[model samples]
Target: MAAVVTALVLLVFLAGYRFYARYVGRTIFKDDDPNFVTPAHEFSDGGDFVPTKRAILFGHHFTSVAGAAPIIGPCVAAYWGWLPALLWVVIGTVFMGAVHDYGALVVSAREKGRSVADIAAKVISPRVRLMFLVFIMVLSWLVLAVFAMAIAGLFMAIPTSVLPVNISIVVAVVMGWLLYKRGVPPLIPSLVALVLLYVFVYLGTKMPISLTDVGLDEAASSQTWIIGLFVYSAVASLLPVWLLLQPRDYVNSHQLVVGLGLLFLGLFVAHPNFDAPAVRMSEEGAPAMFPFLFVTIACGAISGFHGLVASGTTSKQLDSLEDARPIGYGSMLGEGALALASTMAAVAGISLVAACKLPGQGEVLDLSWAVYYDSWAHASGNKAAAFVLGGAAFLGKLGLSPLLAQTLMAVLVISFAATSLDTATRIERLIVAEIGEAVGVKALSNPIVATLVGIVPAYFLATAKISNGAGEAKEVAWALWPVFGASNQMIASLTLLVLALYFWQRKRPILPLLIPMFFVMVVTLISLFMHLVSFWTTKNWTLLAMTVVLVSLLLWMGAESLLAFTRGREQPDSGD
Candidate 1:
């Protein structure tokens, strides 16, 4: 009876969410003109501002924001039970994430297709833009560094995990390069690349590599990978969009859709119940339930990162103002759906007790999944579950065992780190160049010099961070996680502020933005303060360094934003 009621409630909630989003789409995004060509019509010079179809733009926006973090965070949170995690995912997405993502896109589009950085400068102030850019770059670096370590750890842990990712990256790059640079049709090459990637995935699983003997751990290895990745990112971001980010993201977007579909289907069929407590969180937890959940599940709930993607990339591609509603707003709902799907999977599959048993183990074990399957098998007393378990047991025969899955999962976990790292480097370089021009630093204006200055310092810092850790093989996950969460939530809160400002400017009800803004900010600030206090007491230099960067950046952003608003009110506006 309990299970039936729970299932029914979930069904209704998901159904309503989908319906509401669909209604939003029809009313706001449907195009009346049959002759309307998107990127073809709006502007066609193969630059940043080229327009695109709403559907394709939605693809871009969704893919950029959706990644492995959703899977990991929800799975971790599921240790408490599905109820709280699911609740937050739904509420945060509908109220917080969707609002920020959609609003950013609309606001950016209406302003003649400027990047968020530029928009911040105009709508807020230049100081705000500068501070926001710095924060973003730093946040980007942190993300990339952490993930690089994760990916490298996976490679060292089980070399076979590298097969699918490497093959996928290569296929994506080649396909994108051919399509955009050589004038080849994207459809054919993309399909071929995807097919090849899948083939590699299967083969890679069938034949795996073992690297446990390697000295590198998840933490140390990710730092090494970050250094290398940053150098590559520096080169990649500077290149034409078609070369790397777009094409790779295009392939990634499709994989995301397919992967998510398969994952959800499998979970639904399984329909496993979580065995964790309704409120299993500890008061002394580094990332405690209340505030930490908000940051950890940012994209799945409300990510500030989405705003950057919407304004920086997607808005420039919008064909009309109306398309913004669906592509921007609808994609957010889709991401929320994805988060819910993952949360459901975690809850349905894993037992809570097994998940809780991990921190004591002192390693990032693949606990959630193992427990879920084991429990379901125990409950049903099914031979099919036994076979699956046995298959996992023998996975080591091909080196495609549980360890390999962890390695692969960890690698995939940090893919965003690479994306954010070099992306940050480029943004920083741009800022430095702008500063140079502003202050008349003749040598600083040189792109080459600015690029070096930006990439070189971060590279060294990343290397030091990895080496200073407890051990080369021991991944330092606990220390940095809180800061990462706080940074992401801070961004989400800032975005909501932007939304509130926009509505306020137009004299519309600001509740939509204000409410979410307040919720995220309060939660995130609590998290930040807790993190700072914890690190300060411990005198952990590495954590202290990261906390300092985060606090300083956030403080500057706040001051700049307040001053901008004050200045705006003081100046005589077009509307008295």
Candidate 2:
């Protein structure tokens, strides 16, 4: 069953890429001219706007957009059932996620590599640009906070991942120096980096450094990790992309390919059966799967965040206009593959090992998914660990030891998260710069000032605590997580609105984008409204207020979009 699911997903994605992706690029967007100069070349500064190879840029884009969300989201959504999760990732990815990402990259490149929010100004109106900028600001801010918190927590849980994740930074720096300064060919250095990376993975399993070793207690250690991660974020965010961000992400992408390949091979060999149900209409304590599922599985299917990554970084690095088709559309399909692996690891891979958990229930387990996911709390809490353990078990079938396999999987997860952490910080700086320019804060346009303005709030937001109603304090970041998903999906919807308008004005095919645009907007809005009612009922004022603000932004963007279609339909295209 696991092997069958894997094969089917691969086939579908290939067909989508071969046919749908090509059509969307050629017919729908009117295939970009190769002779046109890209922003990467037009504004080359040995920094953010360095022109890059197609394959290398794809790696950076894929790893930046992927992060741990794809793995974590599907694992959590699997509580509803594997089938729904599978279907959403396959369909949402091809139609909405890829299209939105591709369109954003193409549009941004044409607009001189500005972000989607900036493109909104040209596609719609100036006021809409300010509104969209603020919306992206909040979303990117939360991403930095949430992903920082997440990776730091993972370091604590999977200590063996610590060394490898950190060392990759040094490796990336060297790789970049060689490629840019010494004019070294990428293939050999990247290959050597991969080997050295696995060596550290083995060393990590043996040494497994922790802040506790330096005398910090558990709580202090967690805080220390978060602080250290932010420091890295700041430095990486400020540095030249060739020095660290690009090469590091490039290495991390190769790691995922090898790691995912092993998991798929193991699935064919072990061929585990699903221990969870096929379609779970309702779980006892979980939210209804309808709108929740769409938001929960954001990265796998569709996400607004991908648009930020595409327009923010990838567009600035593109070698030519034609590269947008592959780097924008192709990367999302790669992410969809990762999402598929995550869903399988959750439902079928978990059943391959042997462990006992439910005390007093005589649930003497043989590593069954049913026992582990018997409750929503258990499944949700163990989302990251679920993938690591299950993928490790699958790899064990291929003769890797438990310790090595787990360490490798954990390192893979942390690497992706850390890549995103720094990338988001870099983009946050750009978003802050744009916001500052919009609001007339000239000082904030300085890169140093913008970096601080963007990342400082995320640190506080990551560590902010609120009452859990039992006199116990809990993370406000986690508290606002439900609304975060709604906001994220809402951004994707708005980006699609921008894309649809971009195509509508050009007299090109818009229905392909229009269909998914309406579907995602409706689903995310309904999801937000549901959470609004739930927060109101529970009297969670903090979350209620946050949701209210997001709702307002959605309405504002919707109005802007309507006027663009109804009143601004004759707006001329920004011809390059």
Candidate 3:
């Protein structure tokens, strides 16, 4: 019953978003005045901002948001039951992520493709700008650290993880050389690199790269990975976007579309019952809801992180105000769809396993329950379901036979993690450099020096694995969870805050900003309080560290907002 409802809801949501975005594209942006010179047009350069086809822009924007974090979050949160994760993905994306992303792009574009920090400074006040700057830097560092650890965890599980990643990187470098160095059109090498990437995943999975036996002390391994990822990010960020970022994105974009499509098609055909309960009530009688679920499923629903992407790169790529609706709002809808698919897979997988389990049997659902269930029941499903499920059931039934699908999933996730980690590191570097310059630290004004300084935190958090010990390593996951979620939520808050300011200053109806702003604030505050209480009660040093980081950030943001209020200014508008 729940499964049917979920499917219906997901379909309706996807279809509605498609209809709505098209309506917005046609009606709201009907003016189509190229000379009007909105922010995207204002900063128009042939490189990033020039009008490109919508398909290409969609590919770019989608890849920026599509990644393993969404899958991992859904999977983890589903342990509490699919209800929270599923409902949030639907509600939050529609109301929170979609609105925040679209709003950020529109606001940033209106401000001349300047960054969110810049807009905050120019329109709001220098103080607000500083807070945003600091937020960007700290958030970037934390994000880098989190993803670095995630990627390293994978590599640690399978040493051969490095092979596909290295191959993809090499392929990218070579493709960049061909397109940029040898003056070849991007399409040729881009396709080749992409094909080679899949081939590597296929072949590499069969090569027996499991290194679980040769464990590096978790701490040591984590530290090494953090430092290594920092160095990698520094180099990657410094490179021209054409070389690595753009090409990799091109490849990843296709992967997301194809991969997500396959998963959803399979889930529908399988129509597999969802075994997880509607809600998981904790033993203590708490609802096991609210703050925890909201924090856990941040990326799928309402990630503040999306604000950074919208305000940073996507804003720079918009061709005109018209593009903002699709690039921002449309892309978020895609993410929401992905989240729904993941939740379906989790539920279906869980259901299949629980049904087959014998009475008094040992626990049926382990951490890898989805993998196990898909391995068995995919082949056991009704002929109709199996046939309808298409390639998903075929792949699922294949188990470790083809090995390619598993490898593909693994490589896709790892590469996404690597790219995101590096990107975060670069953003941090830029933030530190900008902030240092603002504070008159002339010596730290060098981007490279600021980047190096930024890397320090990455190294520290990454290496904290060893120093904290194996036990501590696992615990940090929980402690850091809310901080990561809150940081992302705060980003959303700041974005909606900016949008509200924009509307307020312009005397436009402020309901859009007010709606999302209120929700994010409530959720984030609830999540933050839970985290603080958890940290203080446990007296865990890792949690303690995260608490300090959050506190300091809040303080800085408060001061910055106070400064903005004092300034009593309105952003200058050059009417188009």
Candidate 4:
């Protein structure tokens, strides 16, 4: 049954990519433009805007967007059930996420690689564009905060991951130097880098390093990791794309492919039965599946962040407009595949016994569906850890040593988080600079200052302590996760609106884009409302105020978009 389900999901994804995605690209995007000059070639600087091959760009785009969010979201949403999460991921990726990402890429490529918010200024009102940029900045900041703490939490939980995660950065610099500076062919050098990364992975398992081992307690170690991560982000943000960002993401993409392959192989071999319930009742203290499921599993299905990556960086490096389908649409499917694998791991690989055990508990618990769901429903701290534990368990079924398997899983999680952290920081820097230029703040227009402005708030947010209900304090990342989900989906909603308006002005078919736009706005608005109620009940004014602002922005954008639609105003000739 498990094998059949997995096979069906893969088949559906393949069919969608071949038929549906192709249809949307041809009919709606009108993707084949022989005369279209991509920005990478038009603005060739050998720096951030150099033309890149489809494969390398795909690798960079895929890894940047396939962060820990997809894994964590699906794992936590397993509280509702695996079936719902799986269905949403598969279907949403096809109809919603792929469309949004592909549209953003195509539109940005058409507009000289400006971001969606920048494009909004041409298609929508200037006021709408300002609000949209603010929305992107806030969303990117939360992403940086959440992902940094996520990587830190993983480091503390699985100390062996610390070595390989850091070493991969050095390996990326070497790969970049060989490929860009030395003008070496990519295939052999990238392969060599892959081998070197795993060599360190093995070494890390054998001689694990951790701040805790050096005498700091767990809390202190986590803070240290968070500090180190922000410092790395600041440096990475200032570097040329080819130097660190592109090469590092390229390596991480390969890591993702290998890790995903092993996970599916383990699934086929083990064929572990699904242990979690198919659905949870409303009485479980979890929000109903309607809106919550959509927000909870944002990336796997449809994420606004993909749009940022699409227009902000990917579009600038596109070799040709023709490659947008595979790089943009196809990457969303790749992320969906990862989300499905996470669901399988959580549902089948993690046994009830293991889920129920206390931290540091030594006894092995019995495997049962009921016990698994109950324990999973109540598991605490960085739900990503659950997926890591489950993935390690699945690999162990293939006869690997438990310690080795756990270390590999931890490395995978941390690497994904680190890739996202840097990418978000870079995007946030762009947003800050753009905002500064628009508002006449010359000081904030400096790249270094913009990068620091982006990182500092995220750092404080990640390290901020809040009461954990038992008198002890905890990192705010986990507490702010729901807010992140809502904000992320809100961005998706706004991006879709931009795309819809673009299509409307072009006199092309807008139904395909409009449907997803409407669906996402509805889901995001409701999710925010629910969060507002929760915050009000708990007297959490910070989140309450944030929610209010997001809701207001959504309404404001929605009203303006509606008026534009009703007016049927032609797009400015400048946009064309």
Top TM-score model: 2
Instruction: State which candidate, 3 or 4, has the greater TM-score.
Output: 4
TM-score of each: 0.77, 0.97, 0.82, 0.95
Q: By TM-score, is 2 or 4 better?
A: 2
lDDT of each: 0.58, 0.86, 0.62, 0.82
Question: Runs in model 4 with CA error above 4 Å?
Answer: 352-369, 375-382, 466-474, 569-576
Per-model clash counts, in order, read 7, 0, 4, 0
> Hey, what RMSD does candidate 2 come out at?
2.1
Off-target runs (Cα >4 Å) in candidate 1 are 1-47, 53-56, 181-185, 206-224, 283-287, 351-454, 466-478, 539-549, 552-556, 559-576
Which structure among the candidates has the greatest lDDT?
A: 2
lDDT for each residue of candidate 2 in 411-473, tens digit (9 for 90 to 100): 888899899999999999999899888888999899999999888888887898986433557
Which lDDT tens digits does candidate 1 get at residues 1-576?
Answer: 223434554564466446744453343323333444443246566755555545445655666676545555665565455677777887877766776777787666656555566667776667676677667656655554454444454455445556776666677678666866697866677667667766766666676654333676555555555566666767765765556666666666565565545444444444455444555553332345667666666667887777877776676677776676667666766676556655554544343112222222344434444444333212122211211222222222334445443433333333433444444454556656655654578887676787776666555544453422333322343346557767888887887676556545545556767888888888887888877777667666677777787777876775665565454333322321
lDDT of 4 by residue, 425-444 (tens): 88888889899988989998
C-alpha positional error of residue 237 in candidate 1 after TM-score superposition, expressed in Å: 1.6
| Total clashes in model 4, counting residue pairs 3 or more apart in sequence or in different chains | 0
> Which of candidates 1 and 2 is the stronger one according to TM-score?
2
Candidate 2, clashing residue pairs? none
RMSD of 4: 2.3
Local error of candidate 3 at 203, Å?
0.9
